[model samples]
Target: MEGCKRLEQLPKSIGSLSCLTNLNLSHCDRLANLQIHILEQPSPLESGLQRRKIIVHLPGEINKLSSLVNLSIDGRIHIQLLNLIGDAEHISCIPKQQTPDELLLSRCYVLKSLNIKRTRYNKDGSSFSCISFSDFHSLTELKLINLNILTIPDDIGQLQSLEKLDLSGNDFKSLPTSMTNLSRLKYARLSNCIKLVALPELTQLQTLKLSGCSNLRSLLNLSHAFHERVRYGLLELGLDNCRNFKSLSYQVRQLTSLIHLDLSRHDFEEIPESIRELSSLGTLCLNNCKKIKSVKDLPESLKHLYAHGCDSLENVSLSSNHSIEKLDLSHCFGMKQDEHLITQILNDGFSQVVCFLNNYSLVN
Candidate 1:
């Protein structure tokens, strides 16, 4: 029911809707207990709305509903509904998302997406050493953000249908090799996982973001993951501030399928000659790469080139046929160029590129 604000408790007869596919108990603030009748009787609850602030303690009986497919328990209040529902079928209430015994996941075989984000472990309690995942093979998107788990179960690889996986802000040092088994995975976000050092090869992955994985060196050597992307033809790659990256694979030249590459604040002193081989390269970011000395030999497909903080950059190569859309070189005080060249590009009827060269010295 949409406006069931005062619906304190669902009656046993309410579970009699056998064919009921979607259940909207979002505003049922007074609902406290999840009875078995809700799981076994009226009908299999298909679409569950969990916006209710007072509907806490979803019963362990939820496991009995084989037809239950989608469950959205967003906010801390709805999350409390889970805390009381431990793996134990006898639990009268749902436990916190980080239950001492979160063993019921295996029962949800048809669940398409399981997003259990943000957890608080009991300070004085040390319970389950592992969260079970052997049963979530059908999950298409699995997001376990900020769980603070030290390790992810290797069974995560079993999600053969998974398309997106976000494991940001965790303490894990490395990913299990089983993660490579996600054959259908397209997007993977591991940002701010400061302790993460190693990653598995994702062959079908299209977008791989590892923005703040600064400590990856302690877990694995650098850039082995990049080689995996090169082999698999990744399209969008973000390695911003990956502290340990000093060199790129020679095979990086082979990444002809790359579209967007973000290397801002990285340690590479010079642009790789192999980068010119990326015929599909669209955006190349080298912002704050202070040691870079030159900017030249870009691929024909480049649309945006950002090298703003390259203070040592003294030379740049540009031709009239270039297709650059935006070029940022504002801090390159060392570069000496003819004023006419910049003027021609800015005033040319055929030029659509926006250039920023604030500190450049104009020569005759």
Candidate 2:
């Protein structure tokens, strides 16, 4: 394959080299018109390379590599490539097709990771039927973005090996019950899905982000195992702009490993007493919670607390020996200045505590 600076088509005889294990044809800018069927077939040489993987930078013509274990493509590819590869474990496609539900769900039994991003499609079109996930058995990571999807397949939980899933900027109204079966899942991000109303039970999940989901209301407790794992493995949880959630005190306490928790823009009237039970909590943000009236029962491990823009907050009582070092109560309308509490904090010699006062005076 010399002097092939601009190979327009792959040699069909190349498949005869069945021993070929690794083939790298990257950055051949002049290479074009690669036929899918030729690349899909296994080479005949029966050498070690025959069992190896294939990496191609050409268009969607890679369905010919039936022996390929790993297939990496640069741009849009033919959907038939899914049916040709018998044991393809990894597939990376540059977002090109309108909807890949059928191609993805068809041979998902062997596929492990699928990354599709920046795909464009009609918002209210028939393309929804093309996105299915009935056979995703070995899938571990699924990332779909800018697809304009309205809902996810109810059988998504069938991917028992799934660990990380990102479905941002979609139109899902609620997660399906089958999602509870994803016991191996650890990280899930559903940010900017404004229509979502509730979250599915994640028994083994550790990190979850639901930012910008305005319609979300209820987040029921998961199974006992789920709660137990979260207590140890869960580190961060974000629920920004979820106005419908009124309380998360009990749930927050269960995550003993949580170091950072954000519950901004909610409607809670006060920080729940249960929050004080979070011994590992270090940063707690309740900013823009206009309905909250007080901040009490401070946690001993807390180092930073943000309650800014809480218009209804009037009284904030800190525990005498609390470990809090930074307190931001700025713009709290109903807060009353208490000189005694301020003096007590200053005398404690907790020089790190940056308290925001109503009169802008130092506690000393």
Candidate 3:
């Protein structure tokens, strides 16, 4: 019930209460195991189809909830419940220690939402097949964090109802072409997937994040027709740390509805003139882009600009229509303390501009 910290196991007879629907066993830090089984076979006189349904909260015993509809587990413990019966509406598992095979989740047909974080395999350099979710046609949100997974299964396109998918902090080198068919997908995060070389075409995607994917060399061959379909719904795009990309301003200008753009830590030498076309751009972060020499042609819709650590930038030319509220230029070694630049920035009516000069003064 409450604060059962030392609880190590559940009583087998606990299943006798066939009508029990809610169970809260959270914060039982010392709990390590649990066993479950059906109790008291249903009699013919029972009114409804006699089935077990429950909600459980434990550290590493989720496998015991074979009839669970909602389950939450703690730490980074792997789970294996492929043949589970009930249709779980929500399931959260923070894997502690185990391989992908140990996570045997192949047959959860009615599962709707699955979240996993910090799941690592038992040994380094070990590979595993992607968990198939074709049976979970009702799934909506899926998250996988720090899994160290090398590849995503090609069959993932089958989940037509999936709305959000996050695959951050993995080792995937590429995605299957089937990803383009996810028409209902709205939000996607692929941050820190350093080895990811390319992306599958995302036609109906609204939010796309590729932050810290250093090896990502190019955007897939997305044409103008594809851009038009995503313009209104696409809101955020992150290409931070994609150093190999030669030019993105031309490609990015197509997303007229883009609100946030991050291109930090790259090899770009100049902000292209085409950047002024993003009339809806709100937030832009260009930190650590050392080759950039100046800031020019920024859109008036820009609200936040982060140019910190750009040691090669010599000047910043802000337009009179600038609406920037927050500007960060810390550690910009090449930018001299010019009174005109400060006066111009203030005259632009910005609320806050952090300029950490070498002289140790906050120029706002």
Candidate 4:
């Protein structure tokens, strides 16, 4: 019954399906009521102790369906709220004749990856209080986008196996401090969260992307051992378009382990001299930083520098030890007037560097 857009209800007699193993009612925009009974008789398809399983991409209440252990929502579903109610212990083994997709969902005792993006909610008020994290112990990846959720439950920290979490395009002002307890978390993306004012300390994360979070004013507390110079696990950090941050120097001084750093679309007049302290840094992106007038004193370990669209940029200063192999300065018209600056950048010491200038690219 999936994609049955006009399906408003089901017949009560449909409960007689003693061998019904799969029921997918996804994209049923008008489904308002569910009237189905559990099929107690085991099919000859399985032996004595075996039971059949059901996969429901449903829209209504399904607490009575004990065989349903997993629910997946996609772009096809038009439901307002996804109500989840069931036990996890009675998970059934998937039928061998099932499609590969169904087999993947049934293999796990509970949902492993739950993604809900751009979902509309009721006007009265909305809540995800019914969902519990403890039930999904094996869950590894979770993404909740543009849900307009104000707060995530503190129990979110209980997802100890969670590795990647993307909560972009939401309305939360702050995350629960308990989120820091996700010990295995590696990648975290919270982009375009316009109203988000602060974030919890996620020192264990490897990749943290927070682009377009305009209201986020600070991340100084991201490292509890900032003064002690403890190396954080963060390797790639993106803060592009975060215009309201008070300081860029101190903001990243503690992130010395960073390898890729993106500071694009900012209004700063200069690349922070403190960036030189990131000895392990290799790729630095300063694209579209129109207000920056010069590029100087970069890290020696840097291998790629992308500073294109910086029209006010007039100077290029590279130390003899700079190992930059790819340099992009396209659209830095200010430096075009001074041939010496280009010559200095293309000096014999950096013959291996491939430079991209305004209107044309060159390999030296």
* Top of the candidates by lDDT: 4
Winner by TM-score between candidate 3 and candidate 2 = 3
Taking all chains together, the TM-score of candidate 4 against the true structure is 0.70
lDDT of 2 at 316: 79
> All candidates' TM-scores?
0.65, 0.62, 0.70, 0.70
lDDT of 1 at 142: 70
Indicate whether candidate 1 or candidate 2 has the larger lDDT.
Answer: 2
**Which run of 10 residues does model 2 get worst, by summed lDDT?**
78-87
| Model 1 alpha-carbon drift over 4 Å, by segment | 1-56, 59-106, 118-130, 217-230, 249-251, 330-344, 347-351, 359-364
* lDDT head-to-head 2 vs 4, winner: 4
lDDT of 2 by residue, 1-364 (tens): 4334565556655544545433445433344444332234444564533433443333232222222343343222222232222112233632222234544434333456765543443345222222457544667788765445666777787777789998876777887889988889999988777788877656467888888778876565545534464434677778888766644655665677778888888788877677788888898899989999878897888889888888898887877778777888878877878677677778878778777855364533
lDDT string for model 3 (1-364, tens) is 6367667666767656656555566555455554444343442335765534455544334332333443454321223334221222223632223334534653334445777555432224333335665545667887766667777877789888789999887788998889888889999999888888888768578789988887887664556434554344678888888876644655675677778888888777787577788898898888999999988889999888888899998888778878877777778889888677677776665457554554444445
Each prediction's whole-model lDDT (CA): 0.61, 0.63, 0.67, 0.69
In candidate 1, what are the lDDT values of residues 91-140, reduced to their tens digit? 12122232224435444434456555544323232222235576555668
lDDT of 4 by residue, 1-364 (tens): 8777777677765545666655676666565455454444555744455544444445342322234433432222223324333211111111113344654555223445656554432223232322545544566887766555566777789888889998886677898899889999999999888888888878889999999888888765634544565557899999888888866797688788999999999999899878999999999999999999988999999999999899888787888777888888988887664566557656755666767678667666
Model 4 clash pairs are none
Query: By lDDT, highest first, what's the ranking?
Result: 4, 3, 2, 1
User: Global lDDT for candidate 4?
Assistant: 0.69
Worst 10 residues of 4 by lDDT: 87-96
Q: Give the runs in model 3 whose Cα sits over 4 Å from its true position.
A: 1-70, 83-108, 119-125, 222-232, 352-364
